[model samples]
Target: RWRIGYAPESWDACLNWARARKIPEALLETAGLVVRTDDGRVYDRFRDRLMFSICDEQGRVVAFSGRILTADKEQAKYVNSPETPIFQKGKLLFALDKARRAIIEAKFAVVCEGQVDTIACHEAGLEHVVAPQGTALTEHHARILKRYADEVVLMFDADTAGQNAAMRSAEPLLAAGLVIRVATLPGEHDPDSFLKANGVEPLQEIITAAPGFFTFYLERLTKLHDARTDRGKLQIAQQIVEWIAKVPHAVLRASQLQQTAMKLGVPESALQQELRQYRQRDRTVATPAETTAPAEDPGHPAETLLLQLMLTDERVVPLVQQQLAADWLSTGTAAELMRKVLRLHAAAAWNGHTSLLGADASDEAHRLVTRLLEEKRPAPERIPAAAGDCLAALKRAALERQFQAIKLRLAQPGLSGNEVTALQQQILDLRRNLDHIPRLSVWRSAKP
Candidate 1:
C-alpha cells in the first residue's frame, strides 16, 4: 500500500523531528524535504499539505508529491519532489510497487495520469492501475511496464491535453514492443470521478471494451485535422505514417499502412509513394561533399546491388520493407526506384518495370528499374543472405547518421541542463544499438 500522510502547519515541525533523530540537514536537502534560504537558513518544504510518498518498484520511499490543503487561489496547487540520487520522475510510476503482481495476473497494465486516479481504481477492485509521478511517459517507464505485462491501456482525462498525452505515449510504448489500447472516459470524468459516479461495473465495462490505440489515435487525429480536404488529408497521412514507423513489427506496419490508406481514402500505392519519411526537413539527403556532417553515405554501391536482388525475386521487396527503414537510402535514382518497387509490392500491383514506368513515377526510377532487371542476380537460395547483408549495411549507416545528429545537437548553444542530459542518454542508446547490428562484411571495400 502507498504511504499517504499529512504535514503539520509549523515550518519548524519536521526540522525539530529530524534534529532530535540526529538526521543531518544536508541529507534532508538532498532528499528534497526542506528548502534552504539565501542566507543559509532551512525550513520544511511541505507545510500544511497532504503528502503522497512516491516509491520505487521495491517499495522504498524516495520522494513526495504535496497537495495544497487550502483553497487559496494565489498559492500553487501542488509541489513536486525534485530529482535526487534515489528518484527520477521519468523512471518511477506512482503505484507500480503495489500493482505489479496485479498487472502480471491481468496480463495488462492500466496507466492513468495521476496518483488519485490510480488509488481509486485499486479501491474499485481494478488492481492493475498505475500512474506516472507528476511527469509524462518516458521510455524508462515503458521498460518497467514491459516487465510485468505485454499490453498497456492508457486512461487519460477527457480533454485536449489528455488526448495529446495519449498520442505522445504511443511512440515510447510501441517502440518497447508492448500492445497499446486506450479507454476514454466520457466528458471531463477521470478514472476517479467516473468510478465514484457510475460505480465499478460500468467503469470496468468501458475499460474492457476500449479500442486499440491505433483506432483511438486515428479518431482523435481526424477530429484535430480536417479529413475532407486534399492538403488536410496529406497532413493526416504523413502523421499516421510517422506513427506507424515507430512500430517495430513489419507485418504490423504493413497492416497499419493498409488501414491508413483505406481510412484516408487514398490508394495504397499513393500512400507508399508519397509518405515522406519522418522529420524530413531535419535531415538532408546526404551528399559526398558534406562528408564532415552527419550524412548518410548515399553513394554506397550496395544500393545498386539491393536493387538487382529485388528485381530477381519479388520476395526481396517485403524483406527490404521489413528491414531497411524509410529515408535510409539517399533519395537518389536507385533508392527512389527501390521505394517504388516496395510500393508496388505492398499494393499487390507489381507487374514489372513496365507497370512502374507507365505509372506517374519518375522516368529515372523507371530507367533504373529496367536496368536492374536486366542485370544477372544471385541464386534464389542465396538472395536472403545477400539482402540481409545489404540491409544491415543500410541500417548501420542510418544508425550512425542518427548517432552523429544527436552528437551535433549536444554541441549547440543555449541548451538547458535537462536537454543536455536527454541528448547524452540518446547517444548512449544509439551506441548500444549500433553494437548489436551485424557488421557490413560485404560492403567492406565500398567507397565513400
Candidate 2:
C-alpha cells in the first residue's frame, strides 16, 4: 500500500556494513532491508556485535536491534533503529507481526526480552511470542499485547536485575487488568539457548513451573537475606512486613502475610503486631517536624491532622507523594505501605476505600480506617482545645512502639555503636515531641 526506497542502492553495500567488523552477514542484510544509510554509518551503528532484526507484521524488516559482543566494556549491549520513516520503537512490537496470528489463535503470548528468543519460541512450537525493542515493557506494550490475548506469559532472564524488572513491569500490567504469569529460565540461559540445548519439553516444563509474581518475589528475598540467624530473621521479618504493607489488595496481602509467617516459622499474630508497629512509626514521622530528632512520632493531633487531610482534602495527597519519593519519611513498615498506596493511587490503580487497605491490613488496619472515618471532627471553635489531647495520644503510642523495637534490637548480643546511638536518639526525640504537647504539662514540668 506504500512505496519504500533504499539509499545504499544495492544489497552489497548493506553486506559490506555487516562485514566491516565482527557483525555477521545475515544480521547486516536484515539491517539493510530495514534502513539505507547513504553516509556509510550503518556499520558504525551495529559495528562489533550480534544484530537482531526487528520485523513488522508481514515479517518485513523495520528496524535492527543489535547487541555488542566484543570486550569493550564502554559500549551498551543493546542498540536499535534510529527513528526513520519505517521505525518507531514505541509504536512497534518486537516480533508481534510474525506471531500475531498465532497469538490471536492461541489466546496467549510468550513475551521474552530479545529477538533470538522470539525465534526460538516459534521453533519450539510455542509460536505466540514477542519482545520489546531494546527496552523494558511499557504501558503501550501491555495494551498492544492484551488486544490479542487475555493472558501474557512473561519469560525474563533468571537474574536479580531481571527479577526486579519483572516486579516493576507487573505494576503497570496489573493496573491495566492483564493476567501475567512470570517464567524464568534455569541458571543463566535465556530462552533461545535454553531451548536449543534442553529441547522444547524442558523449556515448557520451566514455563509450567513458573510462580506467581508475589511468590517469586518472596523467594528471591529469602535467598538474598539469611533467615536462619536471629538478626537475619528480624531483618527478614522487617523486610517482609514492608513488602506486605505495600500490596494494595487486603485479602491477597493478608494471605501472603500468613504464608510468609509460616515460612519464617513465626506466629501470624507476632508478625501482624510487628507490621502494625512498623506502619504506625512510619505515619508518625511523615508529618512535618521542628527537628530531625532520631525519628519519633509527632503525636495524635498531628496524626489526626494527617489523616483528616489525607481523607478529606485531595491536595494533601501530592504533598505525601512528594515526601515519600524524596525518602524523607522513615524507612519503616508503615512508611513502605504508605509509599506503595500513594504510588498505586498516583498510577490510577486505586479505586475506592477498599483499595486503600493494603496487604498488611488486618483487624488493626480496619480499626485505624474506621477511626479515621468515624472520629468526631473537632469544631472550629474547639480546634485549639482538642488538638493537644489528640496529639498527646499519638505521641504516646509512637514512643512505646519505638522503645519496644529498640529494646528488642539491643537485647541481641552484638549491637553496633551506630545502632546504640540511633536507639538513644529515638528515645530522646520521642520524649522531646511528647514534651511539646500541653496535655503532657506534668511531664514537661518534671523535666529540667
Candidate 3:
C-alpha cells in the first residue's frame, strides 16, 4: 500500500517514454500532457517536478498533481493535469480512496485545503482526511463526503482566504446534509505546518473543540463587521438571513433564524418579517409555473423503478435477469444505466451510490443518478413487493413493444401471405404474454 512510483523529471525522458510506448501526439495533446508550439512541435508539459498521483475512490490514478522540486520565480509552484476523461478537478477529493472508510468509522471527515495538508494529516494518524485539488470544495465533493460523514470539519489555512473558502463551501456541504465545523488553527498556519510545529495532540484539541457553523459564523461575522452600530447590526442581520436561507431543512432554518436574531440583538419577529419579505420578493422574481417541478415522463417509470431496485439490492439482480430482457429498458437512459450497473455489479465494484459518481459517467447520467437518489425509496420490508411491481411493469412494457412492432409489420404494404400469418401469430402471442403479466398496484400498496 505504501509503494512509490516515479515520473521523469526531464522533458527528454518523458518524450522518450511517449515515443517508446507508441503514444500518439494528438492523445498527448488532448490529455494536456504535451504542449504544441507555433512551429507544430510538441513537448512535454511537466518537467523537473515531484509528482503525486491523484486517484478516485477506487484507488485508480486518474490524474497527476506535480510540485516543482526547485523553486522558480517565473513558474508556478504546482501544476495539475488538465480536464480529461478521468480527471475533473472540481469533483475529486484527494486521498478519498484511503480516507473514506476512516471517515465512516470516525463519523466525521476533515477537509484540508491541499494535498500536502492532507498527507500531513494522514501522517499525524488522522486518517479521516481529504483535500480539494488546490481549489475550493465543490458540491460533488460535498456529496461524496456526505455519503460517509455526518459532519465535515474544515481545516483550511488560518487566514482570510481560508475563512472565505470555508464560508463558500459551507452552503454546499450543508445542502448535502452535512453539519460543518471550522477548526481554528493557532496563528497563521495550515494543517501541515501546525502538525509539524506542535505535533498531533494540539491539532486534535483544535479539531475536537471546533465550533459548529452557527457559532463560527457569528464570531467571524462580528469580527468582520461593525456590529455595534444600528446600521451595522441591520447589515449583519441581513447577512445572517441570507446564510440561514441556505439551510434546506425548514426546522433547522427556523432555529437558525431565532439564533441569528438573538445574536443580532433584534426581536425574532422582526427577523421573521424580513425573511417573509425575502420569500415574497423571491417568489415575485420566479413565477409559480417557473418554480414548479417538471412533469414526470410516464414512459420510463418502469425502467427507472427497476434500476432503482437493482441499485438498492444487488441480491435482486438475478431475479431481474431471469425475468426481463435488456430490451425492456430500451426506451430511455435506463437502458444504458442498467447495463453500466450490471457491469459494475458483475465485477463486484458497486459501492452503492458512490460507484455512480466520477469521470466515467456523463453529466446527464450524473444528474439522473442524483434524481434517483433524491427520490423517496421504499422501506426494507417493501423491497420485495416493489421489485415485483417493477418486474411486472417491465414485462408489460416489453410485451406492448412487441405487439406494436408486430402490428406495424402486419400493416406494411404488399406483405406476403406467410409473413401476414406469422406477424398475426406473433401479435397474438404478445397479447397472451401481456395478459399474463399481473397488473401493477401502487407499489406501496402491493403485498409480499
Candidate 4:
C-alpha cells in the first residue's frame, strides 16, 4: 500500500517538466506519487526542472528528485521533498524502490550516480538500476543497497569527478563485504548518453570487460601523465604504487602489483620493495622532533599554497577558487578550508579573525587561514615579479617531496632487476631535467 498527494498545479507542472525533459510518462505513472503543496500554491519542489519520481518497494511513487533546467535567480538546480512519513533520503534507495525484487532475484545491482542515469538504465531493461539523490552514495545508501543485492556494478559517469566519487564509494562498499565491479563508459558518456547512442549492448560489453578499480585507476593515471616520457612514466608509476599500497586484500594487491609491473615494464619484486621502503621512510620521517615544534602536517601544503596566493596576490583569488574546487582538492581538509574562505569571500563577511572549520582547526590550518586573512596584500604591479619567485618555490617544494618519496622507495630491499633499472632511469631523468634548468641561464647569457 502507498499513499499519494499532489497539488493540481503541481501535477500538471510536473508532467510538463517531465515531458520537456524527455522523461517518459510511463515512468511517471508507474512511480505512483504526486507533487503537493500544503496551500495549493505551486510548490518549489519540482519548479522549472525535470522531475524524477522515486518509487517504493511496491513500485509506487514515494517521492521526487527534480533537476533544474534553467538558472533561476533564486532556485536550487535540484530539490526533493522533506522527510515525509513515507520518504527519507537515507532510507529511500532512489530507483531501487522499483528494482529491488529484480535485484534480489538477480543477485546484483547496477548503481549509478544520478536519478536520470538510473532511469536510463531502467528504460534500457536494466531493471535493477539504482542511484543516489544528487549526492554521493552514503553509508546508509550502501546498507540499503546491500539488503537487495550482494554485488554492485558502479555505472558512474565517465568523468574525473565521477571516477573519484566511484572510488570513494568503493571503500565503504568493500568494507561491507560486497563484491564491487567498476564500469566506465566510453568517450565521456554516462549510462544515459551511452545507452542512447549505442544501445545497451555496448554498455553491457563494457561492463563484461570492466577492469578492477586499481587497474582502471592506473590506466587513468597513465593517461593523465603521458607515459611516453621518462619523467611522466616515473610519476605515473609512483602514483600507481601509492594507490596499490592502500589495498587491504593481499591477493588482490599482489595480483594488481604484478599487472602494474608488467604494464610499467618493471619487475614485481622491485615494485614491492619500492612500496615497502616508501612506507618505512614515511613512518620514520613523520615522527615529531624533540625540543622542536612538530613539522607541519604534510597535508597542509595545499593550504599553505592557498594562503600564499591569497595573501600575496588577491588578484589570483579566482584562479585559486578554480583550483580549490578541482576534484583533487575535494579529499583534503585544506581544500575544505579553501572552500570556506571562498564562501566567506563571496558573502563579504570574511573578517581577518574569522576562523575556518572553527576554533578546533589544526595549528597548521589555523595559521594558514589566519595568514590568508591578515597578511599584507601584494600590489598588482609587484605580482608579476612575485609570481615567478612563488612559482619557483612551489615547484621546488613539489620536486623535493617527490624526490624524498622516490628515495625512500629506492632505499627498500628486494627490488627486481627491471624495477632497479626503471628506478635508475627515473632518477637519472629527474637529475637531467634539474640540470637542464640551469642550462637555460647559459643560453640566456650567451644571447646577450
The most accurate candidate by TM-score is 3
- The C-alpha local distance difference test score for the whole of candidate 1 amounts to 0.79
Worst 10 residues of 2 by lDDT: 322-331
* TM-score of structure candidate 1: 0.65
lDDT of 1 by residue, 1-448 (tens): 6688999998988899999999999989878889999999999999999889998766788899988888988877888887665566887898877887788778899999998889999998999999998877887788767756789999999988888888888788999889999999999998999999999999889889998887887887898788898877888887777787678887877777788788888898776665444535324654556535555435556788887777777778778855554535764567756766765564456775565676576766666777777666666777888888888787788678878888889999999999998788667666767888877775443221
The count of backbone overlaps in candidate 4 is 3
lDDT of 2 by residue, 141-233 (tens): 766665466677789777777666777667656554566678988788889888878899988887777776667766777887877777777
CA lDDT, every prediction? 0.79, 0.61, 0.76, 0.62
Once model 3 is optimally superposed onto the true structure by TM-score, how far is the C-alpha of residue 151 displaced, in angstroms? 1.8
Query: In terms of TM-score, which candidate is stronger, 1 or 3?
Result: 3
TM-score of each: 0.65, 0.48, 0.68, 0.49
Q: Pick the candidate with the highest lDDT.
A: 1
The reply for model 3, stretches above 4 Å from the true place, is 1-9, 287-290, 293-448
Q: Which stretches of candidate 1 lie over 4 Å from their true place?
A: 276-411, 416-448
For candidate 3, write residues 1-448 as lDDT tens digits.
4223455666656667888999887877766688789998878877877778888766777777778877577988888887654466777899987886688678899998888889888988999999998788887687667656679999888998998898988988888778889998878999999999999999999999999887799888898788888888888787777777777788878887888778888899998887888776777899878878666444557677767777777666656644544445653566567756654553446677667777888887788888877677777778777877887787687668667877877778999998897577556656656777787753543333
